[model samples]
Target: MNNILNIVKHIEKSIIFILIVFLVAILVVSVVDFGLYFSRLLFYSSLEGWYEPEFLMPLFSSFLIVLIGIELLETIKAYLKDDSIHVELVILVAIIALARKIIVLDYSTMKPEKLYGLAGLILSLSVAYFLIKSAGISMKLRKKSSVDQK
Candidate 1:
């Protein structure tokens, strides 16, 4: 049984490593693509087009996608090191993703209920993140206080 468990663990780690490699490759390609697109937009497009929503929205969205990828990579690396998932990091990634969605959302096309739903989601995630962070800090403080008493 122990041997079987070990084998499963090894397989899991191998799969995770492969995922990391692929993620890194994808992120590199995305960055290069963003750079080329940006250069074209800047040098080829007119000055008026620079501030246009159609052009700027995609550009910012792409940038945020890259950032989100990096954060995911960090989360995976941390999981590998600690052998546990970090709730805080996961929540943070969720918040960033929500922010990206909100940024690129077209308010004109969106319904009122949809907007309200998104607002609720944002509030829930924000509160969850705050609570998680506060709990971590409280734990650390308790540990310190206990050590001081000792």
Candidate 2:
């Protein structure tokens, strides 16, 4: 039984390692893509001799994509460190993704109701993140107090 458990544990670790490698590869590609996209935007703007307001959304979106990728990498790192995924980090990633959408969204193209829906979604995620964070803090405090009593 112990040997079987050890084998299972090894398999799990291998899978996680594989995932991390793939994620790192993806992160590297994302960084390169971000740089290329940003540089192209700047180069074109320089050639045109002036920046355009239309480019603002794309620029912000690209930046946010890189930021989201970094956050995801952090989540994987945290998981590796603790052997568990953190809910707060996941929620943060979700929030960042939503923000990215908002940044790139064409308000004129979207309906008013859709915008309201996004607003509500953001609010819900924010509340959930807060609750999860507070719960984690309370759990740590409880653990500490229990240890002290013991």
Candidate 3:
């Protein structure tokens, strides 16, 4: 039984390793793609006009995509270290995803209610993130105080 359990553990570790490697590859590809796209946008803007406001939204969206990938990588790292997923990290990823949407929003076409919905979403995520961080800090302080008292 122990040998079978050991085998299972090894397989799990191997799968995680492969996943990490794939994520790193994805991260690299995303960064390279962002660079290429931004350069092309800049080159075209330079040739056509001194300023192009339209390209800025796409650039920010791409940048946020890269950031989301990075946050996933961090979540994986945290899981490997502690064998648990961190809620704060997941919330952060969601916030980044929502921020990306807001950043790329076409104000001319979007409805006012949709804008209000997005604003509410951002506010909720901000509050959740703050509460989680504060809870963690309080827990750590409690643990330290208890240890000192003992």
Name the candidate that leads on lDDT. Answer: 1
Better of 2 and 3 by lDDT: 3
Cα displacement (angstroms), candidate 3, residue 76, comes to: 0.7
Candidate 3 residue runs with Cα over 4 Å from true position: 1-6, 47-52, 136-150
Superposed model 1: Cα runs more than 4 Å off: 137-150
Put down candidate 3 lDDT per residue, 1-150, tens digits, no spaces: 656766776686688888999999999999999999988876765646434557577788889999999998998787676656777888899999999988887799999999999999999999989998887642111112222344
Model 3 TM-score, 2 decimals: 0.77
**Residue 18 error, candidate 1, Å:** 0.5
lDDT of each: 0.84, 0.77, 0.80
Q: Which structure is stronger by lDDT: 1 or 2?
A: 1
Report how far off residue 67 is in candidate 3 (Å): 0.9
In candidate 2 the C-alpha lDDT for residue 89 amounts to 81
Candidates arranged by lDDT, highest first: 1, 3, 2
